[model samples]
Target: MDYQSIKNILFKFEPETAHHIAATAFELASFMPPVLNALQKRYLVTSPLLEQDIFGKKFANPLGIAAGFDKNATMTKTLHALGFGYVEVGTVTPKPQTGNPLPRLFRYPRYEALQNAMGFNNDGAEIIKKRLERIYPADFPIGVNIGKNKTTPQAKALEDYRFLIENFKDLADYLVVNISSPNTPNLRDLQNEQFIKDLFIMAKDITSTPILLKIAPDMSPEQAVNLTATAVEAGADGIIATNTSIDYSLLKGAKDFGGISGKVIKDKSFAIFKEIAKELFGKTVLVSVGGIESAEEAYRRIKAGANLLQIYTAFIYGGPKLIADINKGLIEALQKDGYEHISQAVGADIR
Candidate 1:
């Protein structure tokens, strides 16, 4: 049956349960290379126009499955088969901790949104590092997003990130330092300049892997730009323009806790992204993620100076066909704009 029909049934379960069910299916799929190849043949789009080198690695397309989906690095090949150009796994802590309490993942189907207080639940850095070692040299790029353990004190947070970076720096094509998730206590507090400078400087001293900072949407556009500027200056290789947003006003009856993502946060996410792009687009790599749900929106982000785009909530809502449709639509949009390559279209609006 179609994905929507499958989703209808899955939606009946709690959102977290549905996610586990999906992950289980992917685990099964991993045992069958033929099944994966067949899926890739259908879903994976390829064209020179969409290809580019970022972080010194070739990304077959600009779109990736965002970090939260594959927290332990198990779903890379499965996600690639589903047509993601890349997969970023984790929010992995120095040590594994059961994330916030249950009932943590909630869905708002009508709004194509999700509110999650999942708090970086994942197999810790060592386990995830082992997984990456087994899967590296795969066809697509991989990124590992690292966070501090819940019990790790804020003062020791740098130590957590340090350990994670040292572990996965060689395994991942890129590393993301996640200090923006609202679910982790005091994580957002690290968004300040001094912490960012220290973190990136320490990270650079440890590994040469391109490290990006994932910021939150709650900060003002100016604040976002200033903080990211600090990160870039401090040797961060890129910026992932948002994680989930803590602004509950975006959704009616939204739980006041956790962060909100998907369609509801699109405009707010873009506004911050656009402002950041306006200042730093050419200076540093900018990766945009938040509430993107269509080829049109993806193209809009590209024109606004995103070197890469990521989706999690929309991928849940749209499924495999959505990935193919986006790559196809991007080609059409690029041809219509008289751009020979996606790079030409990358900052068309700003240029």
Candidate 2:
């Protein structure tokens, strides 16, 4: 059957456990060139309008699988084969850590969202680095998202970010210094002026790869503009508008304290992108991802000043059809607006 039929069965498993089953499927497929090739034939969406040129790299499309989805860098090929133009791997730390506890991933299908306190869980950067020794030749871009270890205090967070970036910089197309996940204690504090300057200055010194700051969606528009400017001035490459939002008024009694992602964070994410875009539109690339699961959301974010975009929640709720569906919708939206190139429409509404 199709992905939806399979997902119906898989939904019975715990969210995290189900995620591994899915990841393992990709892991095995990564080794089978034929299966991967077949998947590409089945799901890949190609259109000149969807191509994006940024960071001196040309992406096949702007839609990417966000970092938390592939914490181990294991699914770049499968994601590419399934038509994602890029994949961000990890919130990997210097050392492997068992993030939070079991059942860390919770599904809110009613809201088409997920709550996770997976606290930077991964097999550590060293192991992930070895896994990619052969998986980096896919047709799309691969971005590595680095995070600090839980035991490491904020004062020493720089070492965690530096070590991982230093190790994986050359192996991937770009890198994200993720200080936004609410699950990580005091991690958001890293977004403050002094820490951002210090961590990024040290990070930029370590590699020439494009470096970005993934901020939380809970911050105000003013905070976003200030932080985006700070990162750019510190010699950073771009901004990933948001990670996961902490707002839960609608789900007030959901009993999960993890950061929220998917449909709930869309407006927050888009508004932040618009605010930052006001000043940094041409100065730095804006990677937007939050509650985006439709073509309208993607097109609107681009018009509001996003150069690239990503998704995780919608991918799960909508299944494998999500990417191609969104891409098709984006093309229709771009043409309807009388735009010849998607790039020409990047920030069409940001005046």
True-structure lDDT of candidate 1: 0.92
Q: How large is the C-alpha RMSD of every model relative to the true structure? A: 0.8, 1.2
Instruction: Write candidate 1's Cα lDDT for 224-264 as tens digits.
Output: 99999999999999999789988899998799899999999
Clashing pairs in 1: none
TM-score of each model, paired residue for residue: 0.99, 0.97
Per residue, candidate 2 scores C-alpha lDDT tens digits across 70-159 of 888887789888879888888788999888876777888888878887888889988999977777745678888988999998778888
- Compute the lDDT of residue 109 as modeled in candidate 1: 87
Worst 10 residues of 1 by lDDT: 131-140
**Regions more than 4 Å wrong, model 1:** none
Output the TM-score of candidate 1: 0.99
Off by over 4 Å in 2: none
Q: After superposition, how far is residue 186 of candidate 2 from its true place, in Å?
A: 0.8
Residue 171, model 2, lDDT: 83
